[model samples]
Target: MPTCSAHAVVDLDVTGATISKHLYGHFAEHLGRCIYGGFWVGEDSSIPNEGGIRLDVVEALRALDVPNLRWPGGCFADAYHWRDGIGPKQDRPVMVNSLWGDVEENNHFGTHEFMALCELLGADPYINGNVGSGTVQEMSEWVEYLTRDGDSPMVRLRKANGRDAPWKVPFWGIGNEAWGCGGHMRAETYADLACRYATFLHNHDGNTLYRIAAGASDDDLTWTEALMKAVSCLGCTSRPRGLFQAISFHYYTFAGDGISKSPAIGFTDEQYYRTMVKAADIDRVIAAHSAVMDAYDPLRQVGLVCDEWGTWWEVEPGTNPRFLYQQNTLRDALVASLHFDIFHKHAARLRMANIAQTVNVLQAMILTDDEDRLVLTPTYHVFEMNKGHQDAVSVPVHLVEAAPAVTVGDQELDPLSVSASTKDGRALVSLSNLALDTDTTVRLDLRGRAITATRARILTADKPQSHNTPTAPDAVAPADFAVTTRPGAHGSTELTAVLPPHSFAIVELDLA
Candidate 1:
């Protein structure tokens, strides 16, 4: 049993504001129906779409205020050739997807369709270029086609294909997951390629182009070190930025849970503990990634974007395995909420992150079947619940000691997650009780500031594996939180809220 003061205050020393808008960012890949049927359903169909893009799905993502979207692929980005997917859909060449399901791509959704989707959702388009299968000339032309104003091959192609104006895609990636799917190149090799690819990238003034270097996999500190050191010193003449706006990292929560990894929660102690352990590791990965950046450039310059992250369990069996879709439960909700806290706590260097998907792909925010849709996954509720964290400045907190490390399989976790902030003079305390069971309560004490109403919203399910399917849409969802009165307690308050077996709750306090 470990205990200490849970008292804390908003220190004015931390001036950096947390970029909350980014937490709502999402990932869109060329996998399965994620892009073709899931997002781009074609204008000719009677499925009620906006010029081929699913209108209802668009509306749902819009509601979440999705700020940015990474496109052209996940691993697919590595092999993607922008030219093949542009010009004319009829003329666009069809290719086989070697990385994902080995499916045949019809080239139906191209630059115009992706750009159009970005416009409709009011999100920034972050395009991952094909470093493994594409050349420097190809990457350069793709950027010019979208961001360049005057005549260029890409611009001319855009006009000839259909559109006449530039789409202004400011965010571009030199490569994606290069170490794995992009290309199994040494960090040294990838670093040189990044410089070369970024050299040809050009965007109009007022529109900054971010050329992200493909970063390391989980715990690959050496990879980050090698890339950071190589790029910081290897300056390019044409592009002075030298491919250093940000470095992209991809990670998945796969602890060998296998087909047994049903819902994110509701497991034997082994299952619950394993899921939480993986979720807790997020902070460590961020810290290590930031540390590597710090060593290279002591001054905070290169940002770390965990561009892709989500639980990857066996596809819910009989369904198309390529969908990469799974059930989102309370455990999943907590995983998402906790990750938000992790990134928010390290906002200075960890600038951007996107859940593996937005809809019907991986740990999606929204799931759809035909015309019917349900927020479905607790992940959706978690994002909606933690909306307060979007763009809010980070506030420091001193957490009292907790029971020593909780072990799950071969690993251990901190069990307690906390991230706090004050925006527009309002204080928000986001807590994720990573503990599997036996409530671990915190007697929150605000020494410097006075708090008024402590309103709370929670996403909790009775069992860790609890989930919502199309048939029973309301299985696990966010419910009104019951806050307790102070009773006879003076100059103090308490809210004894059950955190569900494995769930996340956001507590908002109106401080006077």
Candidate 2:
């Protein structure tokens, strides 16, 4: 393949929406070792933990400035009972995690433990309430147990469990996937259930809840329409803030084949292109959902939350099939970059998003072994590098000369993706080149700003499939990239960088 050339113009003056820091949120569920070994290593373990919450994992995630963490689920949330996980550890009941590997859940990591983890990471707690097999009273009491203070049955129970102060929980979920693992209900049925649940999810002690109704899978716009229609008929003239604050949907990138997914590593070039195509299609999916929402909510009062997303590939050969653990490679990093680009563009309607799982699961940021060893994946570096864009005002990036497209069968994949944002007198521009063999030189006509200084960083490896293991954790880490700044036409600062194949880069400009 030949080298490609791409040109883009960044409008520094035309800032659109604030890219929510919650968009960089993460999900942690009870599946696999994600809870047991990934985050909870037992308070008695010698692996150096802070009250059974692994210190190393907490310290690693703290660097990303994690905004919010969704807990106890994907499908696991529907089956989980908050009451079972609270109080003394040894006294807690143990149940079979029937959804994920037939392993027993000791209920050691309960409500108090999750809130403790959030406090350590300085992130807001996004608790997913049980809706499938749980009653409304159970879900209502769980919220009160966590947030209500003064005098109440739940508050008394919370104090009895060793907590006197109320915790501030801003985000809550009505259910998981109500259409499938979350109880296989129809769209309209789930909509009614969501309204009923949200009614009793009262705010307590000045703590407001941003309730998110479990939304569609992939392209199931009917689910979104059902929720929107339900909210429209609820007698709310303006926003749907009272009934539900947001609607959440899940999207996972794969090779697009119906049956098997491409391996996380050792994938062919064709498979890589196909994955990129699938990743890029999220833009259209978000647009379609937003349009459906616009019909009922033109003012964009209700937020769109892509609560569960990221690549889902086949598990490692020796790992349990239900564990959902997979290696993260350069391709995974590129996929993340592509999603962030699309997310930044949709920041107005898109309020928050959480990657599928944070550790030892599908497209995780950190991978852990059986012992005390841990390795940061390439996807972690992307989050760290792009952390500057959190809550920053997104600026417009117009492509003048687009990157060459790679054709994989009937699908065409653009090798380049870009997004820009400005915050605190500085501007950040992120770029990703998806081509497996070609280098792309990207030119940026930085309009409406004078650059005092420029800094650049790039994350790439020799191959798209290259990944980091415990022995070589920095195999696909980011490093200082080379970017040239020169005078451009019409008083704009011109910047250029040659991005390698399967590479992701960010340019930070100190604007005048």
Q: How many residue pairs clash in all the candidates, one count each?
A: 11, 0
- Predicted structure 1: lDDT: 0.73
Q: Single out the weakest 10-residue window by summed lDDT for candidate 1.
A: 1-10
Q: Considering every candidate listed, which one attains the maximal lDDT?
A: 2
Task: Provide the global lDDT of candidate 2 against the true structure.
Answer: 0.93
**Residue-level lDDT tens digits of model 1 in 348-465:** 8887888988777778777776554545577887877777777877777665545346766677776667777777767777766666564555445444455677788767766767
* TM-scores for every predicted model: 0.90, 0.98
- Candidate 2 all-Cα RMSD: 1.4
Candidate 1 backbone overlaps, count:
11
State the C-alpha lDDT per candidate.
0.73, 0.93
Local error of candidate 1 at residue 505 (angstroms): 0.8
Per-residue C-alpha lDDT of model 2 across residues 1-512, encoded as one tens digit per residue = 67989999999999899999999999999999898999999889999999999999999999999999999998999999888998898899999998999999889999999999999999999999999999999999998999998998998999999999999999999999999999999999999999999999999989999999999998899999999988784334576546999999999999877323668898888888888899999999999999888878888899999999999899989999999989999999999999999999999999999997899999899999976799999999999999999999999999999987888899788889999999999999999999888999999999998999999999999998899998898899999999999999898999999998889999999999
